[model samples]
Structure formats: structure tokens, C-alpha cells
Target chain A: MTAAATAAGAAPRRSARRRLALVLEPYLYTVPSVFLIALIMLVPLAVGLSYAFRDLVLLDPDSGGFVGLDNFRTLAADAAFWNALGNTVTWTVSSVVLQFGLGLVLALLLDVPFRGRGLVQALVFLPWAVPSFLSGLDWAWLFNPVVGPLPHWFVALGLMTTPDNLLSSPDHAIWGPIAANVWWGVPFFAITLLAALQSIPPDLYEAAAMDGAGAVRRFRAITLPFLAPTIAITIMLRTVWIANFADLIVVMTRGGPADSTQILSSYIFTQAFQRLDFGYASAVAAVLLVLLLAYAAVLVTLRQTFLARR
Target chain B: MRAHVLRRRLFRVLHAGLLACFLVFALFPLFWLLKVSVTPNDLLYSEGVRLWPSRITFDHYASVIAHTEFPLFFRNSAIVSSSTALLSTLVASGAGYGFSRFAFRGRAAIVGLMLVSQMFPLVMIVAPIFRLLSPLGLTDSLTGLVVVYTAFNVPFATFLMQSFFDGIPRDLEEAAMIDGAKRFQALRLVVLPLTLPGLAATLGFVFTAAWSELLFALMLNSSAAASTFPVGLLAFVSKFSVDFGQMMAAGVLALIPVCALFFVIQRYLVQGLTAGAVKG
Candidate 1:
């Protein structure tokens, strides 16, 4: 039928209908995805926003009534919320920078020819497949002074004066989750950067090497420029992602020995799960969503201006 | 010439040494997990910092499998992950084919919307999803988790599928159409088999993602019947507070399916990833 319609010797109306169907076909294919995403994601996002304006408790029968802005009002004065906001910034920056740095080094290393490269690549990237929750628990065990080696090693290296669970120290507790976050997250960046590295033409390096460029000089001139766009987008997306990643923090410290490791996402989890305070949790989640959107917008605009300048 | 050769030799050795250090750093925590899981309860603390256990035992694994509800959790997770993988892959491959084949109106709008979906803090929707699911008899159900995970996974999976579809020649499908096969028939007969690697990659990604999701599993399923491996492992953390061995054993089991899936899909993922990067 399609061939007949396209042959230009067939009925004009039939060909028009065929063209119309071709136009509609893409929408027909996309309908399921759009419908599912709208139903499961957007509708909930709208409902969740509405939830922030009302009193919503899971167990309380009398809590459905609107108490507009009350959750936000309480959040303003909540000390833990404020601390969590601060800790969130620290956590996001530290984890992103460390993960990117280590991942870049790994990607660069793997970009070259080496013996057993496949095996080394697989083993190095294995952490990315470990469930985040398990990664959290595993690291928590490693930091335990009793059954694990890390703290004892730390003491021996003089990083600590005595063997104590670093996860239990309020002054330094946030580092526990950050360490696990960096370790688990490094593989994600490495894989992405490696792919981006592979896409760069080899002659860019070869030509530079022929001109007597040293390793550091070649990286600064050839590699860094090529990786910049990927680095920007990856860093932006990962910042937002790591900010919302509360699992490691929640599992390792449960928001801590004294709520010291509490970040905004974990606080939201605690409220929604433990206290059943859906309204406050949704409110905090709303704040996080808004902040992330702002961050993403800024990044997009910056990249736009950057490309325009170039 | 001698100095340059010496420097080059040193560089090679340094590269190997640094790579080895990273390998150990990456594997050490997991190595400890396995070591702890196999260590006898008596030696768990006594050989606390040992590089290896004095003796090994599978008692922790046996207890976790025989006594605890981990087997049930594993079954639930398998059901959820597999179904999620199949459902998401089917829907996404369709969307991907559409994106790849058609230059239709509203394509940009649809792609933009998909990107927007990727931006939000998904935790914001946890409570609302719980509310939405419970009324429909979906809470504490494998189908509920499947539905939730399928939606979460479809956007990225669709992009992956689209890239795979893009890699295929349009002429192949056009030839099928000219040969009297319907477009759907052409996809099924000609294009589908060729995209098997991409489909495998999508399934593996979705399966691993659903396997590891914990928050919704914890919130939506209060009953033991619907608990996933992560949820069940957390329960053991509290129940067997003193038995690190058992907890690690359960943790190791949770890692198995995902790790296996990872190995299967990593190569396809490399290809899909490059295509995606180049396209978008």
C-alpha cells in the first residue's frame, strides 16, 4: 500500500492519507512513554506540590485540611533544616570534585593501550554496579573499629590519634558518607569521560606530540578543551543528583551521631518515613527541586553563552 | 637518547603501578565484604584487621538463606526487576524507533519534556506515589514497584533505544516496506533482530536499577511479602545487630544479579553510550 501510494500513479486521496499516517506515526509510538511519564511523574509532581500546602500525615485522620505555608514557616526556624542545607552544599561540592578528579585520571589512564586493560577496566568500574545502599553499608562496616580495618589503619597512619568510628564524630562525621559517595560515584564519571575521550580524534594528540608537547602540555592543550563540554554537563547533572542522593547518608549514619551528617534529602526521607510528616517532607522536597532547577538553568545559560563566545 | 628511554620506561612502570593502586582501592571494600561474610562469627572481631580470615565458612550465607526472609525478598526483587526490564524495554524501544525514524511535528517538545522529567527530585513524589498507589490496590505489590520503576527508567531507555535504531540503515526497513511488509511487520522481522544488543543493554540497565531501588520499596511495602533485597537487608541490619557476618552475606547476595547483568551489558553500553553522546 505504501509503495502504491508513493508510486504517484495511485489514488491521490490514498497518498494523502498515507502521508498523514506517516506524520502521526511518531506520536503513536511516543504515546505510551508520554502517558506513563505524565501519569507517574508529572501528576505526582503536581500532587506533591499541592501536598506542601496542606497538612498531610499518614496516620492522622484529621490532617487533610489546608494549612497553607505552615510547613514552610516551620522549616524556616528548624535548626536541623538549616544545618542540612549547609551540609548539603559541602557534601555536593566535595563529592563532585573528588569524583571528577579521580574519574578523569582513571579515564585518561584507560584511554591508553595497556596489558590486561579489559580486566582492569572491568574491575575498576565494578563499584558503579554495586547498589548504592550496599555501598553505604559496606563503607559503614569498613569504618567500624571492631570488625573492620579502616579505623585501625587510620590510627596507624596517624590520620587519627585513636581507633574510633569516624562516622560517630559530629565534627568529622559528614566525611563518612562523602568518602563512600566519592568511591562509588567515581566510576560513573570515569565511564562517561572515557567514552568522551574515545570520541576525540587521535591526530589531535599525535600532531601535538610531533611538536614536542610533553604529557602535561598535551593534556592542557588537547584533552582539556575536548572534555570541557562533557565535564560541564556531567558536573552539573551530578551535582543535582548527588545533592538528592540521601541513601548513603541515611544508611551509613542515619543522619548521624547527632544529626551531624544530615543533608536536606535525608531530612526529607526521615520526615516522610519515620515521622509520617508528608506535608513537611514535601515542602522540603519542593525547596530542593526548585534549587536544582535553578542550578540547571544557570548551567544551560552559561553553556549557551560560552558556546556563543567561542 | 638514554635519558629519554629511561624516562619512558619509568612512565610505563608508573602507569601500571598507579592503575594497580586504583584497582586495590576500588576492590578493597568489596573484598572486605566477602571476607567478613565468610569469616566465622568467632573470628569476626578477633581477626578484625586481618588481610584474610584464618578459616572460612558459609554459615552466614546458610543462615541468611534458610532462616531469614531473604529468599522471599530475592524472589520479589527478581519479579519486580525482570518485569520492569521487559516492560520498560518494550515501551522505550517503540519510542526510540519513533524518534529515530520520524521527523515529525512536536519532536523537540517531546524531547524537552523528557529532559525535564530527568531534572526533578524524585523523592518529592514518594509520598504522592504512595498515596496514588494505595487507593488503586497497588501498594505493597510487585506490580506497583514495577509500574513505578518502569516510568522512572523509560526516558533514558528510550534515548538508548533511539540511538540503536538510529544506527540502523533506513533503507533496510524501506526495502521491507516495498516488499509488502507493513511498517510494524518490518520492524518485527527485519529491524528487531539487528537491535538485540541494544535491547539487551536496555533490559540490563533497567533491571539493575529496579533491583537496587530502596526508598519506594521501603515506603510502599510495609509487609514482608513485598520487601526487596535492599529492604530485607536493612531489616537484617537491625534484627541481627550483632551478626555482621549474616548482614554481609545478605549484602553479597544482593550484589550478584546486578553484577552479572553489568558484565553482560557493559560492551553494548559502551557502544550505546557513544552513539548517545554523539547524537545528543
Candidate 2:
């Protein structure tokens, strides 16, 4: 009787240990990633946010002093910052709109079953494989009149009075990078939208067609509603991405020709990378982060409200 | 009926035409790159706008390969990108497995943090990362690029892997565990084999991202010895702005690995993203 009671007591203790291990197993698997992200990305992000308040300059031993909004004060008065902010709006809006518009058209075209569709899809999406810097350079070379065909084509088409480098003109220089960005980013939108498009039930379209709906009518009734969610989420995410995208502009224009092509991201790059002014760059970055967060928040709330109504 | 037939025929023609336009637009720059690379220096400016050069030569390719720092840059890029891919995939698989198998405390919060990480402006951390890594003797090092790229890639890769794991049924591993196996062993033996494709897609995706990365590589590694291809190419552009043929040759070389990987993995990427869309 005494041995039996001892055995029963030990059974619960063993099971409890097993239960604890099971609970901890997930953490064991997940903790390394959490630890690394926190250490490498999150910690640096925090430090960067703090750098906005301090005077931090690269290679300057004496510059790490608490500045307490001094960077912000300077940024407020800075004409270049304001210009970049304006240009950022132009850049993000134009790029997102153009990419979405073209991508939707491409997706719609690809949706219809046709011969050699696979080959066509592969060919059209090829530009996305080009690296951003290379895309920028490629487009830049195209705009150069000396060796590129674009200027000659433009002149022949009467779109330009001369075979001049479009990249050198301050008034129209932003378009150079924008064109590159559109080329590189269109495939991303097309792929996502195409997936969403494919997911819609073919029966819905068939049923609508049988009810005497035309192509436009079917698209309006069935396709638009199904695509609305994906479109919203994609455009939101892409806006944030394009706004932060500096590589194309940096490589293509270097924010030159009177800083006309300098969006907020490139401006931040310029301040940090070229000027080595870490504090000011972080300040600009902090502002950009806040703006992006606000934009995202507004989008989320709009989505929530829209969903609730639906 | 006759009008309907003609309208359909017209639509088909228009569709084909539009597709052709898109194909040309998509390929023109790459074709131009190739064209310039093969065009002799004398012919580059003279027949710049020609549909095809009268004569083509591989002299630019030979020179870029034999004469420039491109080989070194390519090596550095290959090392950094591959290391980032391998390490990120490994870490992500663990987290992905965790997210897929267990619903535990803090899971939602962790997922949320990762999503937020995707949105945060990476440019913000450039300076602080520089500061942070400099002290650790990682600045101007290939190891530093690998670490940063791995961390940047892990969040997206984890989500990708989790989606893949979600597609797989839990019963496979459960059966293994029931047959006298530990959880990790089940993962290693059963789930890992199934997840090979997921691992490969993640590897390719991360590799492309790292290979294309220019900013951090440019900022962190200033020395030519440590420079990745993008930085080295940009430097070459500024230093030898007139050498269009050789520069285009180098550019073509940079395009090879990424374009090859992209064609292979793009379908998987699309599937992954679609799965993510439905779930999200």
C-alpha cells in the first residue's frame, strides 16, 4: 500500500514536467528570432529615434551631445526639407497611382485565357528582376541623349524640341526616377492583383454572364468588390514602401538639378550619407516615420469603417 | 451575330497588340543594356540609337572581367547574399514552426511586431546601425552586411515559412511524436523534408533582396575591398562615366544570377503572397 501511494504521487509530478516542457517548446523555437530582431533592428531603431534629439555626426568625436529639438528647429526652418516633403507627396502619389493603374490593366489582360499566356506573363514581369540601382542607371542611360535612344525618339515624336537629357532639366527631372520606379514596381502589383483576380469564383462570372451581364457589367459587379480588399491593402503597403524608396532617385538623379528630385527619403540619405549629419538625418527620418504611421493609421481606420458598413 | 464575331476578332487583335507593347516596354532596357555591352566603343556613340549594331564584340565583357574590381565585388556580393539567405531561412524556419504549431501567450504581439517592422523606414536605422556595428568591429565587413541583411529578411521569411507550414497538416508530426519521437525530431524528420521547397523559395527570395541591397552596403562598407557589386558599379560609373560599353557589360553580369533566380522562384513567391492575402 505504501509503495502504490508513492508511485501515484510521482506520476503527476512527471506529467507536470512534461506539460511545462510543452509550453516552453514554442518559446525555445521562437526566442532566437525575437532576440536577434530585437538586438539588431529594434535596438538600433530605438537608438536612431533617440539620435533625433542629439547632435550626432559621423567621424566627429565631440558631436554626440544632447540637442533637445535643435535638429527639429533647424528642420522647420530648412527650405530644402519642405521642398523634399512636397516632392515626396508628388513622388509617392504618382508612383502608387501609376503602378496600380497599369498593374490592374495588365492583370485584367492576363486573366483572359490566351495562347502563350505563360510566356507573355514571364516576359512582361522581367523588369522587376532588375535591381533598383541598376533600374535607375538603366533609365538614366536611356534619358542621356549622347548614347540613349529615348531623346531621339522623343524628338521624332515631337514630345521634345531637342534631343536633350531629360535628367538634366530641374523642371522635369523627377520623372526620370519615377519612370524607373514604375517599371520596377509594376510587376509586384500585377502579381498580387492577378492572384486575387484568379481566386474569384469562375462560376460567379458565368452566372453573371448567363443573367445577360456584359464584360464591364460583370467586372463592376463581381470583380470590383472581390478586388477592393486586396487593392486597398496593397496600395497602402506600397505607398509606404515607395515613400521610403530612395535608391532609384539616389542613383538616377542624386537629388540634383537644384534638388528637385529629392524626396524626403533621399533627403534623409543625403543628410546622413553625403553630409554625415546623423542627427539631422535621424530627425528627418523620425518625421517621416510619424507621417507614415499616421498614413497607415488613417488607412486602417478607413478600412475598418468600410468593412463595418459592408 | 456577324457584329458580335467581328467585335470579338477586333478585341483579340487589340489584346495581342497591347501585350506586344508591354513586352517591348518591359524588355527594351535590358535589350539596350545587352546592346551597349556588345557594341564596340567606336560604334556605341555613332550607332547609339540603332535597332542593332552592324558589328558586335565581346571586348567589353572581356575587359570588365579581366581589368576591373568587378570580380571582387561579385565575390563579396555572392558571399554576403548567400550567408544572409542561409542564416535567415534557418532562423525563420524555427519561428515559423513555432507560429504554425503552437498558439501561445505573446504570439499575437510577436506577429504584430514583425508586421510593424516591415512598415518602419529602414533608412531611420542606418546611422544607429552604423554606430552600433562600428563598436563590434563589424563595420566595413562582409559579416556585417550578412548580419544586417539576415535580420532584415527574417521577419518576411518567417511569415512566408509560417504560411507554408500552415499549408502542411499537423497530423504528420503528431503521428511521428506518437510513435516515440520528440517534437524536434518529428520536425527534423517529417516536417523538414516537406518544407524543402519553402526553404528554397525563402532562400531565393532573401538572396535576391540581399543581392540588390545597395544602401547599407554602400554606407557600411566604404572600402573597395569590401564593396558589393552595386556600390562598386556606382563607383565605376562616376569614375569612368565615359566607359558605357564596359559598364553595361558589368551591369549585364550583375543581372545574370538575379534574373535566373527570379524566373525560378517567382511562381512560388506569387503563391506565398496569395496565401498571405487570403489569410490576412
Candidate 3:
């Protein structure tokens, strides 16, 4: 009777232990990644956010004390910061619209099966592999009237009065980086959209076609709806990314030709690195982060509502 | 009937025309880089607008390799990129499996945090990261770069891997577990082999990103001994603004590894991303 009672008690104890293990299993698996990210990324992020309120210049050893919104006050009156904010909007909007439009066209083109499609896809997507700095340099060289064919072609096409570099004109210099951005970014959209496109069942298109739908009608009815979610997410993510992208502009222009190409991101870099004003840089960055979060929140809400209605 | 045939042919022509336009747009910049890299120094200015040079030479490539610090930069980049890729993939795979298998508490919140992490302006953290790493002796070191890059890449890599894991059936690992293997062993013996392509895809994506990173590399590593290819090339550009041929050659060298990686993995990249896109 005592041996039977001990066996029964141990059964419950062992099963309870197993239940506890099950509860902890996922945390065990995820702890390493979460720990690393917390230590390296999130901690730095918090510290960086805190730095915005302090005078934390890189070289000034005496600059770590908190300044209580002085940086934001200074930023409010800074014309360069304001100009950069404007440029940031212009840069993000133009780049995203151009990339999305061209990428969508490329995706639709590749959707149809044809001979040599693979070769064409590989060739066209090659630009995405070129490092951004290289793309910047390559396009900068191409826009140079001294070496590249573009200025000459522009003159021949009657788009220019003379063969001159497009990157030297402050009014038009932003387009130079924007052009390079489109070239490099189109492949990303194409790849994502193509994947989404391919996932659509062929019979949906066939059914729509059989119901007296033309290409435009079928696309409006089926393709657009099917692609709506992917399009929304991709565009939202790409907008945020391109807003923060400064490598091309920095490399190609250094925000030069009268600070015309200085987006908020490059402005932040310039402030932190060139001027060593980390506090002000972080303030500007904090503003940018807030704007992006607001943008993302809006897009997510829109996507939700659109999906819900469907 | 003739009208229908004519309309179809017109559509075909329009499609091919657009494709050709894209091809030319995509290739023109690279072609120009190649053209300049090959043109001998004497003819660089004289044949500026020429589609092809009258003569081509390997002198630029030879000079960049033999005379510049590009080789050191290339080695550093390769080391940091590969290490980041391998490390991020390993960490992400574990997290990914957790996300895929378990519907535990706070799962949505964790995923939300990751998504928000991807949205922030990384420029904000540059100074903070420098300060954080400097005290730990990670500043001006390759190890510092690997650690930082791995953290930045882990979120996206985790998502990529989770989507891949979600594609896999749970029964395979369950069966292995039922046969007396531990869960980790079942993962190693059954699930991992099936996810080789996913691991490879994550590796390629992370490697390319780490290879292309310029900002942090410039900020953290000031010493030429630890500089990455992008920073090295930028320094070269400013120092030798006149050496177009040598600079283009260095640019070409930078392009090789990423292009090769992209070629191998673009197919799987599409597949992996497609899975995520549909699920979302």
C-alpha cells in the first residue's frame, strides 16, 4: 500500500514538471535573440533618445549634461533643418512614386510567360545587387558631362539647352540621386510584387476573362484587389526606408550645390559627424522617428479598414 | 479576324518594347562603369561619350589591386559580412521556430516590437552605438561591426525565417519527437535539413546588406586597418578624385561578390518573401 501511494504521488510530480517545461520552452528558444537585440539595439535606441535632451557633443567632454529642450528650440529656428524637412518630403514622395510605378510595370511585364524571361529578369534585377555607394558613384559619373552619354543624349532629345552635368544644378540636383534610387529600388518592388502576383491562381484570371472582362477590367476587378495588401505593406515599408536612406545623396552630392539635396537623414548625419552636435542630431532624428511611426500607424489602420470592408 | 490579329501583334510589340527600355535603363550605368574601367587613361577624356573605347586595358584593375588598400578593405568586408550572415541566421532560426511553433502569451507584442524596430531611423542610434561600443573596445574593430550588423539584421532575418518555418508541416518534427527524440534533436535531424534553402536565403540577404552598409562602418571604424569596402572606396574617392579609372575598377571589384550572391539567391528570395507577403 505504501509503494502504490508513492508511485501515484510521483506521477503527478513528473507531469507537473513537464507542464512547466512546456510553458518555458518558447522563452528558452527566443531568449538569445531577444537578449542580443535588447542589449545592442534597444538599449542604444533608448540612450539615443535620451541624448536628444542633453548636450552630448562627441568631442566636448563637458557636454553630457541635460539641456531641457534647448536642442528642439534651436531646431525650431534652424533654416537648414527646415529646408531638410522639406527636401525629405520631396525626396521620399518622388522616389517612392517613381519606384512603385516602374516596379509595378516591370512586375506586370514579367508576369506573362515568355522566352528569355529568366535572362531578362536577372539582367534587370542586377541593379539591386550594386551597392548603394557604387550606384551613387556610377550615376554621378553618368550625369557628368565630361564623361557620360546622358548629357549629350539629353541635348539630342531637346531636354537640355547644353551638354552639362545635371548634378551641378541645385534646382535639379535632387533628381540625380532620385534617378539612381529608382534604378536601384525598382528591382525590390518588382521582386515583391512579382511574388504576390504569382501567388494568384490562374483560374481567377481565366474566370474573369470568360465573364467578358478585358485586360483592364480583369486587372481592376481581380489583380488590384488581390495585390492590395502586399502593395500597402511594401509601399509603407519602402517609404520609411527611402526617407532614411542618405548614402546615395551623401555620396553623390554631400548635400551640396547649396544644401539642396540634404534630406533630414543626411542632415542628421552632417550634424552629428561634421559638427559633432549629437544632441541636435538626435533631436532631428527623434522628430523623424515620430513622423514615420505616425505614418506607419495611419497606413496600418487604412489597411485594416480596407481588409475589413472586403 | 485581321483586326484581332493586328491588335494582338501590337500588344506584343508594346510589351517587348517596354521590356527593352527597362533592360537598357538597368544596364546603362553598369555598362558605363565597365566602359570607363577598361578605357586606357589617355583615352578616358578623349573617348568620353564613346559607347566603346577604341582600346581596352587591364592597367586600372592591376593598379587598384596592387597599389591601393582595396584588397584589405575587401578582406574585412568579406569577414564581417559572412560572420554577420552566419550569426544572424542561427539566432533568427531559433526565434523563428519559436514564433512558428508556439502561440504563447505576448507573441503579438513581440512581433509588434520587431516590426516597430524596423521602422525607426537608424541614424538616431549612430552616436549612441559609437559610445556604447567604444568603452567595450569594440570600436575600430571588425568584431564590433559584426555584432552591430547582426543585431540590425536579426529582425528581418527572423521574419524571413519564420515565414519559411511556417511553410513547413509540423507533423514531421512531431513524428520525430514521438519516436523518442528530444525536440532539439528532432529539429536538427528533420526540420533543419528541409529549411536549408531558407537558411541560405537569409544568409544571402543579410550578407548583401552587411556588405552594403556604409554609415555605421564609417562612424565606428576610423582606422584604415578596419575600414570596409564602402568606406575605403569613399576615402579613395576623396583622396584620388582624379583617378577615375582606378576608382571605377575598385567599384567593379565591390560589385562582384554581391552580384554573384544575388544571382544564386534571387529565386529563393522571391519564394521566401512571397510566403511572408501572402501570410500578412
* lDDT tens per residue, model 2, B1-280: 9999999999999999888888888999999999999999998888989978999999999999999989999999999989999999999999998998899999998986776676666888977788789999999999999999998999989988987788778999999999999988999999998877778889988998899999899889988889999998999999999999998999999999988887777767656555555444
Stretches of candidate 1 exceeding 4 Å from the true structure: A1-10, B166-186
Q: lDDT tens string, model 3, A1-310?
A: 9999999999999999999999999988788788778888888889988989999888788998999999999999999999999999999999999999999999999999889988899889989999899999999999988878899999999999999889989999999999999999999999989988988889999998888899999999999998999999999989999998999999999998999999999998898889998899999999999999999999999999999899
lDDT of 1 by residue, A132-250 (tens): 99999999999999888999999999999999999999999999999999999998888878877887789988999999999899989988877777788888879988998999998
In candidate 3, residue B142 scores what lDDT?
100
lDDT against true structure, model 3: 0.91
* Candidate 1's iRMSD: 1.5
Top DockQ: which candidate number?
3
Evaluated on CA atoms against the true complex, candidate 2 attains a DockQ of 0.63
Q: Candidate 3, which CAPRI tier?
A: medium
Best by TM-score: 3
**DockQ-based class of model 1:** medium
| Chain A TM-score vs. truth, each candidate | 0.94, 0.94, 0.95
Runs in model 3 deviating more than 4 A are A1-10, B178-181
**All models, RMSD in angstroms:** 3.0, 2.3, 1.8
Q: Give the per-residue lDDT of model 3 (tens digit) for B63-128.
A: 999998899999999999999999999999999999999999978887877777777678888877
Error of 3 at A263 (Å): 0.7
What would the TM-scores of all predictions be?
0.94, 0.94, 0.96
